[model samples]
Target: MTTLTVGSHRIDLSIPAVMTIVNVTPDSFYAGSRTASTETIAARVREAAAAGTSMLDVGGYSSRPGAEDVSPGEETRRLAAALEVIRREVPELPVSLDTFRAEVAERIIRDYGPCLINDITAGEADPSMFGTAARLGVPYIAMHMRGMPDNMQQLTDYRDITAEVCSYFEEKMQRLQEAGVQQVILDPGFGFAKTVEQNYELLARMHRLTGLGCPLLAGISRKSMIYKVLDTDPADALTGTTALHWECLRQGAAILRVHDTREAVQVVRLWRKFRENS
Candidate 1:
């Protein structure tokens, strides 16, 4: 049973958990998750908590393909404002700060105490991210992405997607350990740099990653891989998301990072029942 230490909390990975996404940016891929104001952010957090989310993942910068660059100061401001609202409204839930900048992660932790650092770039974008996570004693979530959002899509040329991703995590986990990061989580990066076919290929073989010895986070919530395949939009991909959520659980994913909380929690519960009976 793998466990992740998020702040003062220990999340048991033996049973899957849902981490709802709260995007403070105006231009995140999912319109339903875009919460720009304090009122909207708080409402979203409350809704997720009420729906039984195990963790809240708040993001200031949008990592969608070809997304415009957000300045570090603006990202920090957006995240700080959302964190303030989350802390005030839903203080009980553990929060994960989604970012790729080392300075942003450091500043957020320094001001708001500890949080799970979810770096989409896996410390590739910023060299100091691993050290910052270690220094702050926060659990680090490393996602496998080829490059920054603007160029990531063009760099998806893996020889063997599953093996390559597993190898990447092996190297990254070692680096993180050497940097003194005790707790680590791995994200397969559903839509970050992978194509639709590649995403499915990786998902079908995702269980192989569990051998790397860390909790795996699958963030395929209403992403283009689902909506694009179904000839639908993000708003209509909840069914696809739930279907894929079950697949992720079956494939040994420990956490589901999603936009819809209630359905995802239900999927986890059902998956657990199915597993027990199997």
Candidate 2:
């Protein structure tokens, strides 16, 4: 088992672990998962933590395509409220802040002390984010995407899907390392920059990314990568997410960023049991 340390928290990734999505905004793609109030957000965090979620990703901004953009102050307020409640309720739970803006990250991490930063832009939005990660000394989740939330879907122009993504990460890794950020995780950003066919193609060749030598975080939960192909909505995508989660685990993924923590935990446990007997 491999354990990833960010700050003082240790995420045991020797097996694929589940990261529960705790959206503190109203505009997240999943309507059932949004919790904005302090009471509701704290209750959900405790419940998910008890349900075996290794980390809770609390995002105030919705990165969904064409979603409305929130100001840095608004995002900070929402995250601050949620983090305060979580810290009061369970201070030991490892929490990750999902944002692409370095300014927001700097402010929130200073006020709330988050252990990890999961940026969807992979530090592309602002070049200063890598230096911010180094200064904070937190594990940075570098995701691959083509553009911002508003125009990303339009920028999906890729000739060689796998090679291009690997090349992007190679360049990003070099840039981040030069900036002195060593602890980084790679997320392929399944639906951010690909067609449904390209999503599966990347999953089929998922092992190629493990060659980067960083922990792999697969975030296909309720994403368009699964639901759009199934001709279903986000609420009905749990089973499809679990199926793909298992496939990712078998392919050597270190973490699974998901909305449904209980189902993901079950999948990882069952996969481990099956492997042991096989």
Candidate 3:
């Protein structure tokens, strides 16, 4: 069984786990996910915890394609507010800070002490990220993305998406290990740089990524791959999201990062039962 250690928290990966999204930015693709204030974030955290989420991922900077870039100071200020609420309301719940900036990662670890770092750029955006994560000794989530959010869509020219992603991980994992960063998690980055068809292809071959020797996290909750394929909006994409989530579990995803906590938890439970019975 694989496990992710963040600070003193050891997350068992023998069964699938749910990581709830708590966006502190107003411009996130999903409007419902954006919490405008600390009070709202605190309430959302409580709701997600009650809904059975094993972890909470808080992001101040929106990684949605074409998102306006915020200054690091602003991003840090936003994240600090959300972190304060998390520490005050649910100190025991394991938290993951979603940002690719090494400055933000370093500051958060210095102030908050060992929360997981979810870097969408996989250390390519900021050169110091791997070293920072290594020094902090926290679990690191490295997502596969070709470029920054502002223009990543233009950078998706891969011969074989799965093979390329696997190679990317193989290379990045070696560098991270060399940097003394342990407890790594791999995220395929559903819609970052891939087209809708490519996203589906990657999901179809997601099992291939398990060979990287890290827990796989599938963040396909109400993403464009679901809404666009279904000819619907994100608010109406829950059914499609749930359907694909089952496929993700079947393909060996250990963690599901989602906006709908209750449904994701239920999916994990049902997937575990199916695996046990099979």
Candidate 4:
């Protein structure tokens, strides 16, 4: 089991935990997850907390493949609004800021105090990200992606997806630890830089990544790996997502970053029961 320290809150990871997604961007790959207004963000936070989510992940920038890039200023403003609502309405719940920009992360930490930083770039996009995370002393989530979102799909030329991803984490984890980051979580970036086949391949061998000795976060949620294979849309991929969530847990994932909190929470609960009995 792994533990994550976000501010004064210490998250015990003996059992799998759910990190619910609250996207403030309009162009997120999943249409159902886009929440722009403060009222909607507050409502979503309240709902996710009630549904038993262990953490709330708020993102202003859209990281979907080929997604339009938003400036740091805009991203900061959007995140500030969302965080303000979360601070006011659901201050008790731990929050994770989903951004790869160091400036945006620094601003959020200064204003919001200590929280988790879920950087998709793994500190590659912004050279200052690791230092900023270390300075703030927050849990950093390093996701494995080969390239920028606009061109990541074309860069999926890994000789061995799992091994390459594991190697990537091994290198990045060393840098993060050296920079004084105490807690680092691994996210395999399921749809960011991999082909549909590669995504499943990595998931099948996900347990191999556990040797890195960090908590694994599986963010398959309503991603294309589920919908594309099922010949369905993201809107209808909940069943498939739930199925894969079980596989991820069985493979040693400590966290599930998901758009649908209730279903994921149910998955974690049932998976825990199954693991206990077996």
Candidate 5:
């Protein structure tokens, strides 16, 4: 069975893990995820813990398309505050720090302890990220995004979305392995650099990526890929997100990065029951 050793905790991926999003940024694509103050951050963490979230993915820097760049110092400050609250409230829950900067990852780990490094750039944005993750000895989640967030929307021109993404992960896993990084999770970046049509195509063929032998993380929670098709908004995308979550489970997704922990946990439970009977 595939597993991730996060700090002292070994996360079994046989049952899909729900990694709840705890965004500290001012402008994440999903408004419901943004926690601007200490009270809100603590409340969000508590709520997720109560809802049975497998892990908390706290991100300070916003990666939404066209998001303004945040300085590493500011990002670290925001994350430190959020991390402090999480440690105080739910110290035992596994945490994943969503960042691409080696400096940010190093400082956060040094001050707060170990956390899985979830880099949307996958070491492409920061050359030292792989080495940092390796040295810190934390599980790494590498997402496949073509360019920086501000310009990623313009870089979506893949001939075969699924095959190319699979190749990208295969090469990335090899590189991470060579860099001495252990336990890498692959995220195909559902809406990062892909168009709406490309996103659907990638989801349809996501099962192929499981052959890479790394756990897959699906982050399609309340994304435009769902709302755009249904002509709705993120707040109303929960039902659509649940439908996609079921499909992701069917396709062997090991983790679901989500904003709604309760709904995701329920989906995972139902999926587990279905799998047992199947």
Candidate 6:
């Protein structure tokens, strides 16, 4: 079995864990999770912690396609504020920064004690990100995105999604290791730049990515792949999302980044019970 250590928290990989989403920006594609205020953000984080979320992923800038860009200063400002609130409310909760800017990562580490770095760019946008993660000795979530958020949807014509994604991770892992990055987490980026069919195809073939020898992080909660396929909206895709999370956990997903912490925690609970009985 594998394990992930963040701060003093050690998460077992034998059973899948939930990573609650805390989007502190209004531009996130999913309207339900968008909140720019620090108080509301902390409340959500506290709720997730109380509900038993194993990790709390706090993102300052939304990476949704065509998302309006936020300057580094603005991102730092928002991230620092949100993180400070969460830190004060729940001192033991493990906080992760969802940012691609090296400066933002460095600033958070310098300000906060030690937080995980969840970069959507996978060190592609800023080469120094890996070095900084290594320097700070924090866990890194290296996701696979074909292009920047603004132009990603326009580049969803991949001939072979799995092969291309595996190749991308191979190269990215090499660069990050060369930069001395200690812990690494891999995310397939479900809907960032994939068609509905391609998204399902990726999910069906997700187990193939384990060849990279890293823990898998799946973020398929209420994305367009489910809502669009179910003929519903993000707010109405919770059932579909939970249904898919089962398949993801079965396919070796170590972490599930989701909007609903209680539901996901319950999912993990029942899944572990079933798995144990089996």
Q: Where does candidate 1 clash, by residue pair?
A: none
Please give, for residues 1-278, the per-residue lDDT of candidate 3 as tens digits.
38788787778888789999999998999998999797899899999988988899999999888788899999999889998899889887899999989999789778987799999999998999999999888899999998788899998898999999999999999999999998899999999899999999999999999987889999999999999988999989999999999999999999999999999899888888887899
Q: Summarize candidate 6's per-residue lDDT along 220-240 as a digit string, tens digits.
A: 999999999899999999999
TM-score of each: 0.98, 0.97, 0.98, 0.98, 0.98, 0.96
After the best TM-score superposition of candidate 5, give how far the Cα of residue 86 lies from its true spot, in angstroms: 0.5
Candidate 2 lDDT by residue in tens digits, 1-278: 26778667888887677888889898999898899888899889888888888888889999887788899899988988888988898787888899888888899889878568999999888888999999988889999999887887788778888899999999999998999986889999898867888889999898999998888999999988888888999999998998999899877788898888888999989999999999
Model 5 per-residue lDDT tens digits across residues 216-265: 99999999999999999999999999999999988889999999999999
Question: Against the true structure, whose lDDT is highest?
Answer: 5
- Candidate 1 vs. true structure, TM-score: 0.98
What's every prediction's RMSD, in angstroms?
1.0, 1.3, 1.0, 0.9, 0.8, 1.3
Off by over 4 Å in 5: none
**C-alpha local distance difference test of each model:** 0.91, 0.87, 0.91, 0.92, 0.93, 0.88
Off by over 4 Å in 6: none
Q: At residue 38, give the lDDT of candidate 1.
A: 79
Give me the runs in candidate 3 sitting further than 4 Å from their true place.
Answer: none
RMSD to the native, candidate 3? 1.0
Cα lDDT for residue 160, candidate 5: 98
Query: By the TM-score metric, which is better: model 2 or model 3?
Result: 3
Clashing pairs in 2: 1-14, 2-14
**Global fold similarity of model 2 (TM-score):** 0.97
Q: Write the per-residue lDDT of candidate 1 for residues 1-278, one digit (tens) a residue.
A: 47777677777778899999999998998888899987898889999999999999989999887677899999999999998998899888889999989999889888987899999989998999999999999999999989788888899998999999999999999999999999899999998789999999999999999998888999999999999999999999999999999999989999999999999999999988988899
Better of 1 and 6 by lDDT: 1
The list of candidate 2 runs beyond 4 A from truth reads none
Model 5 lDDT on a 0 to 1 scale: 0.93
